[model samples]
Target: MAATSLSLQIDARWRAATTPPDRPCGMEDIETASSSVVIVRGKEADGSGFWVTPSIVMTNNHVVDHNPDLKVGKDFPATVLATDSVRDIALLSVPNVYPEPVPLRGIEEMPRLADDLYVIGHPIGRNLTVSKGIVSALTNDDYDDRQYIQTDAAISSGSSGGPVVDRCGRVVGMATQTLRGAENVGYAIAWSQLSSHMDRMLKVVEGSSPEERELTYPSDQTEVVAKYYSTLGAGELAEAYDFYSASRKARLPYESWAQGLGKTVFIRLVSVTPGDKSNSVKVHFYSTEEVNAETWEWRTGEFEGTWTLTREGGLWKMNESNIKDITKPTTSP
Candidate 1:
């Protein structure tokens, strides 16, 4: 069946009405944003529980791994679309339409500390519960350089994969972790980090192989792709180059190619099709920059290229010469 467009407003009402009246109330805008939330049910050691959405579910690898019955196929009702152990993020496909799929906004664009935020999910079997609070701090406890969105939003068990919306109802993060000793203190995997994973999933979705019955991408590949965008954020052009194949790096050197380009460039992996043991990856990139001392310029472009890796001295290196056609789209992001 064709997929349906999930509407946030409709889902929000559904969630608000279902939640307990005793909990702190969520904003009207937040209810409108709750349509994307969902309850993920499966038999784990902890028994059955719920999860929320953007249609992208994430949890600690251990939570999922602990449940040996939680196989990617069969037992785990949903598809294990993609996973990134480093970030401890996983993407699952919900066959049914949500009516609304929340968009992931960048971390730099998120609200400041003490700003109000809301967490929507099923806690203790009560689905669609909404918890509200303010950003307490931005901590990088693990030193991943990726800051966790620490908030007082009353997150409890079974809140994983739920939407953490800002006052405006825009999703700024996903409920991922929480502290056991602290009250109402929980952490969310920033939306920016989640987007990087979604981008890779989109590519897999767009480029399904005929022989492959399910949608899945290598965790390592997803990491490389996510890291590539992260590098772009820090203006580390050379580091970003490492993710690309050797030929791509040579042709599109960071310093020379990005010289006139903007400081920030948006990248979306469009698709990844199979190619004789390799893969054909398509990407869409949007860049904005100042053309001169006067005005700024904005451009939307797309790139399509084939990717392959070869083992050299027991190490896999991206084969630069394997890159094929790279196109630039005529639109903007």
Candidate 2:
């Protein structure tokens, strides 16, 4: 579980192309691509994890199994959502929402051999860092159906569960291990091998507990309103988006929802009550916002609204948010 240093053979040609004249690509560019990565520390083991969904973080199973006190709902920073030891993958439910989730590239989307790649994680318990390399080959592993992406991306003892991203910043694999006694050689669980496991893991996350079910797939109208606003208030746009009716979300799109509410500072739930209609919930809340990222201007508003909800795919979702008025946006001088 202890951390070890690693050496990677950075492709000189690729590095030159990615790096700017004054600013090198190694530290700055890698850090930007690592926004979704988190330092996962347990009692016995510590590693890295990347946000796959608003609430879910993906890492290696061995990392969790090595930790003695880390368990679902027992840990402070995160809880176990699901694990597949055979596949060496684990999903943890984190408390804070990530600004964005790492885009998971599917098997069909695998990059070509010799393409530049980057692995981002906290190596040797250091702050998140990046190592550069090239895809050497695509090879099958001990597992019958699993495939591995061979790369020279420098990864160490603490790098397990971190992401191996393509030049375009799409996650192509999860750094799993490095060949012992070898130089600049590492192995990753390809997205092709991970996609099926991820599908099953998410289902386990939704069905594991009643609280999770209510949070992800509520049957009651009150629960739908409560969960949606709560997630939104926490800045969990992707998870909150799931609480929207498919049709409405399709029309608005996640990108627009994120941008529209980008300046939201906070949301306070005042009350939720049954509406005139059976599937609607009247919601009351107060919100604060920054007018712009550059300016210090602030505004406060109250939203009195009724959310029309409907059942879809066995979960209650809000079809629309009808805010009657903002009650005057009080600006700070």
User: Would you list the C-alpha lDDT of every candidate in the order shown?
Assistant: 0.53, 0.69
Q: Write the per-residue lDDT of candidate 1 for residues 1-333, one digit (tens) a residue.
A: 112221111234323433224545457667766654555555662211223344444444324532433422123355554455446565555444444345333332656899989887777535568888999987774433465799988877767657787865666787777888878779887766665655665454444332222313333443434445445644677755665665656677667767744645454434333445543322233333334535556444444454555433322334542434345445676
Using all chains and alpha carbons, the TM-scores for the candidates as numbered come to: 0.50, 0.51
In candidate 1 the C-alpha lDDT for residue 333 amounts to 62
* RMSD to true structure for each model, in Å: 15.2, 21.2
Per-residue C-alpha lDDT of model 2 across residues 54-106, encoded as one tens digit per residue: 55678997777536455322244666655664467877756444343443332
After superposition, candidate 2 runs with Cα above 4 Å error: 1-31, 69-76, 98-108, 209-333
**Residue 227, candidate 1: C-alpha displacement in angstroms:** 18
Q: Please report the candidate that would top TM-score against the real structure.
A: 2
Poorest lDDT segment (10 consecutive residues) of candidate 1: 1-10
Q: What is candidate 2's CA lDDT for residue 10? A: 20
For residue 313, model 2's alpha carbon misses the true position, in angstroms, by 28
What's the CA RMSD of model 1 in angstroms? 15.2
